[model samples]
Structures are given as C-alpha cells and as structure tokens.
Target: MLVLMLSLVLSDSLVLADSLALADSLALADSLALADSLTLTDSLALVLCDSLMLWLVEELSLADVLSLSLALTLCDSLTLAELL
Candidate 1:
C-alpha cells in the first residue's frame, strides 16, 4: 500500500511539471505575437507619416503657384492703367 501511495505521488508530481512547462510555452508564444503586432504598427505609422508629408508639400506648392498668379495679374492691371 505504501508503494502504491509513493507511485501515485510521483505521477502527480510529473503531471504538475508538465503543466508548468506548457504554461511557459504559451507565455513565450504570447510574447512573440505581441512583438510582431508592435512591429507591424510601427511600420504602418511610418507609412502614414510619409504620405502626410507628401500631401503637405503638394498643398504648399499649389498655394505658391496661386499666389504668384495673383501677383502677376495685379501687376499687369496696374501697368495697363498707367498706359491709358
């Protein structure tokens, strides 16, 4: 009877060890997944920022062109009036 009890205890200990190992493996997998998601997020953010910068540059260029056209029109009108 004592031998049987010892065997049962040993089996229980083995089961506990196996469960601990499984838990550790799951935790490691979770950490790796989180790291992968963070990297993807960073890459997407960089793309978004680059796109925004390009849009801003285009808008500024358009504004500069409009301002130059306005200035030229005003100058032409003034010259024409003086000639008259």
Candidate 2:
C-alpha cells in the first residue's frame, strides 16, 4: 500500500516537471515575439551595455572587484559552474 502511494506521488511530480517545460517553451515564444517587434539601434545598445556594465562594476567588493553579475552567480553553485 505504501509503495502504491509512493508511485502515485512520483507520477504526479513527473507530470509537474513536464508542465514546467511546456510553460518555459511558451515563455520563450512570447519573448521572441516581443523582441521581433522592437527596434534596437547599435549606438543605443552600446550605451545601454556600458550603463549596465557600470552598474555591475559598482556592485563589486572593494577587495575582490568582481562584476556584480559574477558575484551574484558565485552565490549559486549551478550558475557558477555554468559560467565557468
């Protein structure tokens, strides 16, 4: 009886994981559609990137001086490994 209950719970989790994947796919499609409608110029992109870089740089520790994005990634093991 316990085994039967465990199997049911496990199956439910598989269904949830599959659903999550489907949702992610839909989100990606929506994002692509939005990007397709936007017009970003090269100069504006560079300025935005510079501003973002400055923001990230400002978040670094005094001693280490790593970028803020890198610091945030270091806090999570999966992201750290993926970044490397």
The best candidate in terms of lDDT? 1
The per-residue C-alpha lDDT of model 2 at residue 14 equals: 97
Model 2, span 1-84: residue lDDT tens: 999999999999999999999999999998678667655653344345446557656665655445544554343333323433
**Cα RMSD, each candidate:** 24.1, 11.5
lDDT of each structure?
A: 0.62, 0.61
Per-residue lDDT of model 1, residues 1-84, tens digit only: 999999999999999999999999999998678558655645454454445446555666777656644554354333322422
Residue pairs of candidate 1 with colliding backbone atoms: none
lDDT of 2: 0.61
TM-scores of the models, in the order given: 0.45, 0.46
Which pairs in model 2 have colliding backbones? Answer: none
Clashes of each: 0, 0
